[model samples]
Target: MATPEFVLSLREKIGHDPLPLVGVTAIVFRDEKVLIGRRADNGRWQPVSGIVDPGEEPADAVVRECREEAGVTVRATRLALVQQVPRITYANGDQVDYLDLVFRCDWVSGEPHPADGELTEVGFYGLGELTDVAHEHVRKIALAVAEDDPASFVGGR
Candidate 1:
């Protein structure tokens, strides 16, 4: 399968007025290690995430992003958190305020690899050894996973 066109188009469309974008991310853990990817854009570690296509449910987007970014099939088990930031400024000078739906999921199949070119590295990190997480919200998701509170959205600092 090819990389979704929506991902490419959305990058150009960011910063447009009335930009209404929804995205999904996942916190996938096994044996006390959390799956994370080093973003090629920012070089910081973060969970699998991508923009939600039009008409796609956030849960579905989560699973799709997990597969696209990590090359792993996952089943979303629960709604972990909803991160709605009014404005997010990107390194490319494209600002996007998004409604981000985060989910807790279990890896169903496929070896973890950087399927999408956006990720530079991918691996499972122990809770105590995570370092330089890319975004505050990503860190929050990791903390929530460590606490075993799928609903928690607190930072790991």
Candidate 2:
């Protein structure tokens, strides 16, 4: 997993302090299937996701992450969910709190494969038959699956 250059630069100044960042998840779909990948770092199955580069559109980040991590071409159809992820402390001692933007994407072309080393395996699975997936990711997939549904805002008022 390549750390974005901007993050590395920030780390130099912040050290291990908690940093707020924006991230995006691409819940790519094809018919009845959803794209999933086994992350190389944690071996957890998840939707293709990555940090939003500075000044990059969140939707564009979704497309880029899917291609770079899963070897698939996808069109981000809609924003599915917005939520604040719990703070995560990396093995390197960096802490981050991410504002996650989840997008529902339609597969345009290409078969799923681990194009980059971030994932060990990549493939599509039936939405109802998913296994080895974290509960949070499963929730994201569920919220994104219905095309007519409005995007979910996890917290409110």
Candidate 3:
């Protein structure tokens, strides 16, 4: 897993302190299957996700992440959810609070494989075959595929 240069530079000053960042999750679907990967760091199955580059569009980040992480090309069709994830304290003691933008992407081309070292395995899976995936990701998938789908804001009620 490569840390972006900007984040690395920030960590030089902040050390292990909490850093707020924007992230994107690509819930890319090909027919009845959804793409997922086994994370190299945690070994947990998850959708294609990555940190948004400074000044980059979130939807473009989704497409870039899918290609960079999973070796697939996708069209980001919709914004599915926006939520703030709990802070993550890395093994190196660096902490991050991520505002996650989940997108529903349609597969355009390319077969899934681990394009980078971030994921050990990558492929499409049926919704029912996600027993190994995190419950939060499963919920994202459901929300992304719902018939009455619209972008959901998790807070601000």
TM-scores of all predicted structures: 0.79, 0.98, 0.97
For candidate 2, write residues 2-121 as lDDT tens digits.
Answer: 899999999999999999999999999999999999999999999999999999999999999999999999999999999999999998899999999999999999999999999999
**Candidate with maximal TM-score:** 2
Looking at model 2, the pairs that clash are none
What is the Cα-based lDDT of residue 4 in candidate 2? 91
The better-scoring model by TM-score among 2 and 3 is: 2
At residue 68, candidate 1 shows an lDDT of 80
| lDDT measured at residue 95 in model 2 versus the true structure, 0 to 100 | 99
Candidate 3 lDDT score at position 105: 93
What does the lDDT read for residue 148 in candidate 3? Answer: 47
lDDT for each residue of candidate 1 in 47-117, tens digit (9 for 90 to 100):
88888877888889888888888898888878877767568665555566777777888778887898978
- What is the alpha-carbon lDDT of model 2 when measured against the actual structure? 0.94
Question: What are the lDDT figures for the candidates, one per model?
Answer: 0.74, 0.94, 0.94
| Better candidate by lDDT, 1 or 2 | 2
Candidate 3, residues 73-106: lDDT per residue as tens digits? 9999999999999999988899999999999999
